[model samples]
Target chain A: MDLVFAYLDPGSGSIIIQAVIAGIVALPILFRNRISAVVRTLRGGRAATPPPPSAPPTDDRPR
Target chain B: MSAPRPGQGLVREPGSWRDPAGFVYRRDGAIHRQIAPVFAAEWEAYLASGLHDRLVTRGAVLPFEDAPIADALDPATAWRVIRPEMLPVISWPWEWCPGQLRDAALLTLDLALEALDAGFTLRDATPYNVQLRGTRPVHLDALSFERRAPDAPWGPYRQFCRTFLAPLALMTERDPRLGLLLRSFLEGIPLDLAVRLLPRRTLLRLGLATHLHLHARAIGRNADGKGAEARAVRLSETRLRALLGNLRGTVAGLRWEPEGTEWADYADRTSYSDAATAAKERIVRGMAEAVAPTVAWDLGANTGRYSAIVAETGAHVVAWDIDPGAVERHHRALMASGRERITPLLLDLTDPSPALGWGLTERASFLERANAELILALALVHHLAIGRGVPVEMIATFLAGLAPNLVIEWLPHEDPMVRRLLAGRHDMAGGIRGNVAGWPLFREEAFRGIFADAGWEIVERAPIEGSGRVLYRMRRSGRA
Candidate 1:
């Protein structure tokens, strides 16, 4: 979990950016997945969108 | 790599060392993989997870069967062994056309996305992890996946960008040939270097700017080894999925339509008359039928007009051409038709893809994979002979090593097509000297003499009437 030793580089800049990026966009993605999951429950069947893992990932647009 | 492991017969593949989880070897002509003892738990988990079967069914991962540890290089170090279905030919990402590489990138992201849902994470995202199954991409490394650590950052995030997105974007915005940059930077073109070479307009695209230009700056600022400042970065599973979604959209949106290349439309333009074309087809078909090869190579296979004929004999064809646009156009059509027999590639014979990576052997050269049973070299010799002036003896010997049977066409310098190319040449021998005096005379006798010197004997000869074109069926003199 820590960048004590990254398999690729010592700088760990790559890891830091990912964390910052995730922090910036986390809330919107949480809401979207929640809404999609609710929609699947309402349809009264397995998710036609995602989380089933048999089909493709749901499309996501940039914020 | 001859560090000499414990096993007496295991010949380790050069490219298998980068990943510590497993190493692949060849035993009795079939590829065998031995998982390291350290990853035993993960290997067992993977088998029981049903994800292997799921991915295999989706045509994402190459199918494999369990094998005994007794056959491994060292049972002490081995935890599991699997024999994956053999690839007809092992080709690298550098030799692939743009369409092929894009498909590979998409496959990588798709697998990573699906793995997350299944409580697994892809460890790395290098293009080398994927190989072409005909025109399609299949993930070959079984160890790239591991059980997810809750709230952990995607470890290969930068790797995915450096190896796949940067190369694809450079080709899309600049020139398709820029994809060959991957050949030199085997670990994927460095993002900083790519940002410099890429056109400024790339920054105008939000995804490209953030993912490439901005990503490069991030890495640049941390170029100083600040191990003290390095800290654990947590990204929630939802955030990781969001990052993956952004990547998927960016990659899916980037488009490169192959167009306006010299040979992309050469198939529709002037080269041969109707009857000459038909005669050439007859010769190629008869030779293909006679050999009934399991695999064939069509050198200078522009747009695959003749490659389609060779594939009719049920042989998998590797259609090669120098023009990226032509190879791109050829592959797009194969994808559309769902024909898994013809694999089109961008290649230049004068300067072919060479053995590269650790010890210059990790990735195999183009000629190393040229183990095809038949070779169809139609309308290509002139370019090498007169246009490029490569010595005939050199060309003949190289062709001899590729395949046993050959369906080749020799063109004299007097033909209209040859004349046009000749008009562009001034002092002969590609303007290096005032001609070496018939050093490259494309005469019929010279053509026959060269291949003869290369230990090939002519089986049958047919000359297209009054076209200055001759077709021959030749075989290695003593191969039978």
Candidate 2:
């Protein structure tokens, strides 16, 4: 990151793609998280809370 | 405009010219961020809304303190100047190994997601906004966040793809060397280029397909202004969250194994006998402990075997290696072992990372950001001296500028590694194939005079018994 903040270009094409796929791009993740949340609830939410849509997996490591 | 102009006691950071909200400058030897009057409101809200505090607590961003109003060096341009925590070293995305880059990408996505909850948003997403301390990354750009733009498409959508997503996919699917493409495409690898290089099977991965292939096509289509409504499109916070989630999943799913790189297995497959290796390690450990430097650079640090030893002396070690695989593996090991002192980076000394971006100073050249107090050149001299055909004189001069003390090794021609390298070369003047009598690197005479001329005086010299290799802990004489 050379020293600048993105003075926020949000290129036209990228915005268009996001517009085209925003509805379905996250379906699988949404469904997976929803299912996991329900499972956690059914298990009485002992150690973990039903996470929000954007929360990282419980631990920080993605690998 | 109250912008930072040339010729002030304040030296505006080179890469800061791109950001309109604010720019960082050094005045009186302290880093101060000068916020333009236009961004004053947002800067205030960033603190009042407690976003700064929240992110600081999570180690998400570099914490800062508001300096007294009188301290503003460029009062005309400075609405407010705040002092930010100093980042000891800055390593660019090109030098980051896969794991480090992956971690940086994750941090970018995570910050964006967290910002949304506070009714604020990340106006842009780029790896440059983040800095790594060891394996941990912290956001560096404070001006990227703003109150959410309702009904607006995520402004940094392409920036994210170009800067993070594309290179990541290329690295995981194509080759880790493609990650070095960041050096060429500082804006991030072009999506179309990434799409072309990625295997066709990647189209099956939904997130990649949409963000890369479809994204590239959309950009191309809009290049002609056909999608005039791209700016008019309304993205609900819900949909935006969905987009963020998708990007996170795609990035998290991308993986690159640190195996099969040229030097990944070099440590275990040694040219020296077990006794020689052990003797070398002991010697390196003793010398590093004696110096006890705060920071050490292990040039050509293959697997960080010696870097780990240097760090044991309680120094923060920056382990740089030419091999991406070796750096990646070393970084992963450090992360797994919870060691935060050794930062493994990808660097090819023959052609090191340069000061690039705006004015070629925004991104610092490798030498520009060098933070070594002791340099470990173990088993590395021969490679740079012969493998790259760089003369010992230039090599010594370069090392002199990197640190005040040095632990370097000299391998004679009879040494198996040098012999293996020499077998392929007929010329030995000073290059890969130069005539020997002119400059035989195998002899210390090849480097001794050059080292002295470069202002390095040998403090101690120890020869590895049996391997015929010599180790010297040298003290630098002049200023680096």
Candidate 3:
């Protein structure tokens, strides 16, 4: 007999689904500081001036 | 492992069977976890990770020992069996006060950060995975850790938000009574629900905005097609750490000072004279020392005064009270003192925690876990008898089922506290006096007769001077 195991039930699966989408939108913002640095270097300028450390990503952009 | 003896069956703890990685079972009063073959890779990697050692060292996780038990219920499925050190008392999230829940949430985040540092991630973040080792929250699931993938988001993010962040946020911003919401949503408080309940000002807080409000909106918008499409998304380890740090900061910052409850100031308003209070304390202390139980349950343990007394004798005491304010105060004291033997929890003795979740066995009820060798009912019987209108016989029967020996107090109807509880209440008898109608036959002799009939032998009884309260040390019949 073949046995199948499900690690994620519906509740967990749904959460993972939502978290995945949020991750897509949030990850770039999370690494915006780093991304800006790389972008500046590609344009031959120092990475976009790193945001003040006190400032968290305050962007309310829709995902 | 060896074959089981004929007719010797293993008892799988009902609440623990849900997690597929393993199931907790008991044999001859010993608690064991059976790691399944499906979880072998993760289990082996976790054992080698030193993360377990780190957590066990700091008492963050309950330590277990690899043991070769005689048999497994299903040998084909069992990869390894380990015997975990049993916690004296197991409690749930609903029973936790605001402070306890916050501490637990912070513990989960701390462990998550540490696990990420160790190249592993927690698979889930259910509050149920955490249990109190005294006042400290200890993670109980060994298989919850999995090898971390580079640039992968934390798998338990939603769970953490629902179980820890949302509840803490509610208790901090709203009323602590919102903590009871966990009793219904066994999985967790839906992020959407939390967002709706929280005030608009909370949106200004980054942690609340990112983890709860925005997350709820994201979940709602992506309800059908979005999650599957976004599975390919990845988060760098640095980003994951930052997320966890934000959660930890939020949890650490949230605080609620327990106040304005009728029972929070109980000890201050007590009618006992100084001499009588000392005598009562001496009696409780003497009885506790006499029994010397390894585990003690103090029912209605307001602020845990007697519980502290029991703990001083090297016994683990689960101090339970219905009043959230009192439980919160007791928990704060326990945390401040770093008391490692007393656990304070919120429990309504009249309506205890019931069987909940799938098949109604996911979480054990109060009575299922209330058993202890020594039980203290100080100043509690009257509350159950008069405050709740439970008959003395029913209360005795329930208390008898909890422990073999009991230290109980009987407050006469004339006692000030009892009178206050009975005041202005309609009497059931419909006599000219309105107060007597609802009052049951709570006479001292009747109470003793009920306990005696319930199979308890009174070991010692005393009336404190200056008060009409009688304390009895009753031993269950048939127990030495």
Candidate 4:
């Protein structure tokens, strides 16, 4: 098993780990906000109005 | 040089035992460092503070990345990952010409000074850590430094002196070529041995007095079971800074001008007509277009005149020559031209890099690591053939193993240069011979017969206009 792991490209391995960590960290925050909105609506609370979508096009330049 | 069996978990390198911290082989073609669990936090702190980055940026140390601790079977143990930009060759200190060795020594001291300022000290000081990357010194041991111990004296101080200071002092004061001591002693020269070899007058030099003389005395006192009282000499940070300054001053003062090697005189003596030289350059460029090698090695590259032609075609080239003066001038030319791809190294092909360190497994041998697609061995066979008395078949056999495609120049005895080589030697000759006896020299039949015996298929041959020299492009065939 150690020998098999050693043969894998280090750059490829680092990229895979980075992706996995990003997904794991993002999932919890996404689920919590969705749950809070649903609960507030069930309690007959007024929904928070959405913000205006009049913002300029977002900058997409790479760092 | 033996290959390990398929399932071996971690093939502990034979050379690893010399290092205090264990080094292990990973299957990915990279070496990993495994520090003791006690040093784990210190290693992390050292990396987090940008010390590694600073050293690497300065070319003082090899760079590494933090590896997951869980990678190890024992979660308690921690490790670091280093993917070293592979060197074209691992030159032993013994093989280094005087100037090359001096450069390595000065670079080591420069790294030590920078490392100390980064709040860490080197654990081991060995010349093996310094490797030449394009005529520039780059440290190879990524895990050599650790967080300084507040209570312990600087651990590697004496070692630094032995590995760099003593060798440099001997080369400067006595004979420049004394750096060859590295070959006889795998580790740096022993301090006691260095003390003996140095002249009595060296004892009068202030820097040598304190470092080599007193330092060796301190080690001797400790060995004699002298009380801890004698070992209690401590230095303030200010004094330590002064010591480092003194070392830097000493290194800067010692210099050697590479001179007096046969090939160093080659540029002035070369017999090529201007048109012939230009034609040779065109042939090299055309060959480079066909092969398109990412990396090429030019063997016997006398001052790298033809190597530059291949370099112009956008290939990284390692121009190797046996002559120190020639290599020095070649390196200077490449530097002045702002050419980053050409690396000139001093090497004698008669005896190449051997497997070194314990059980001969620590460093890769010469042929074990070779560069890419094509190799140019132009105008060099005569030296190996007539000068060294090596058979043509033997020479072909060696070149075949090094690269897939070879551009070889066959200089017939009728060539002026070939006549110059034979001017002094006994004329017992018939021709360049194979294992079998009695052959005619430089005949086309003899050349073909030798290449065939060595399992190389001649692909192309072109004769030079003004000389009997013919260039042959040969492809290696599958036969051992």
TM score of chain A per candidate: 0.39, 0.45, 0.33, 0.36
True-structure RMSD, every candidate: 5.5, 6.3, 5.5, 16.3
Docking class of 3: incorrect
Candidate 4 lDDT by residue in tens digits, B115-232:
6677666666667778777666678876666665453244455556766777777776776557767655675677778888889987787667666766666565455333334345
How many pairs of residues in model 3 come into backbone collision? 6
Whole-model alpha-carbon lDDT for candidate 1:
0.81
Q: For model 3, which pairs clash?
A: A37-A47, B427-B437, B427-B438, B428-B437, B428-B438, B429-B437
Please write out the lDDT profile of model 2 over residues B37-111, one tens digit for every residue: 888777777788888889899888999888865667667777887898986667888888878888999999988
TM-score of chain A of 4: 0.36
List clash counts for every candidate, in order. Answer: 0, 8, 6, 4
In candidate 4, position B352 carries an lDDT of 79
C-alpha TM-score for every candidate: 0.89, 0.87, 0.86, 0.77
TM-score of 3: 0.86
Q: In candidate 2, which residue pairs clash?
A: A1-B128, B355-B365, B427-B433, B427-B434, B428-B434, B428-B435, B429-B434, B429-B435
Worst 10 residues of 2 chain B by lDDT: B429-438
Candidate achieving the largest TM-score: 1
Q: Per-residue lDDT for B1-480 in model 1, tens only?
A: 676445766788888886677889988667999987777777777768998889999899999888998888667888888888888767777777778888999999999988987888888888888988888999998887888889877878888898899989888888888999998898888889999999998899766887788888889887766444545567777778878877887888877887787888888885668888887788788888898999999999988988998898899899999998898899899999898888888789999999998999888898877779988888888778767877778888888988998988887766788777677777553653344335444657877888988978999898876576888989988632
Question: What TM-score does chain B of candidate 2 reach?
Answer: 0.91
Q: Give the TM-score of candidate 4.
A: 0.77
How well is each residue in B1-480 modelled by candidate 3, as lDDT tens digits?
778583266788887766678888887768888888888888888989899999999988889998764455556688898988988888999999998898888888888878887898888787898998888799998778888867766667878888888988898799888988999888789989999999999989877777788788777876676555556656666556666776777788889887898689998888778898988988888899989999999998999889999999889999989888999899888888887889999988877999888788878888878758999998887777656768778888888889888999988667787667666446633552355433444567877888888889999998877787889999989532
Model 1: how far residue B58 lies from native, Å: 1.4
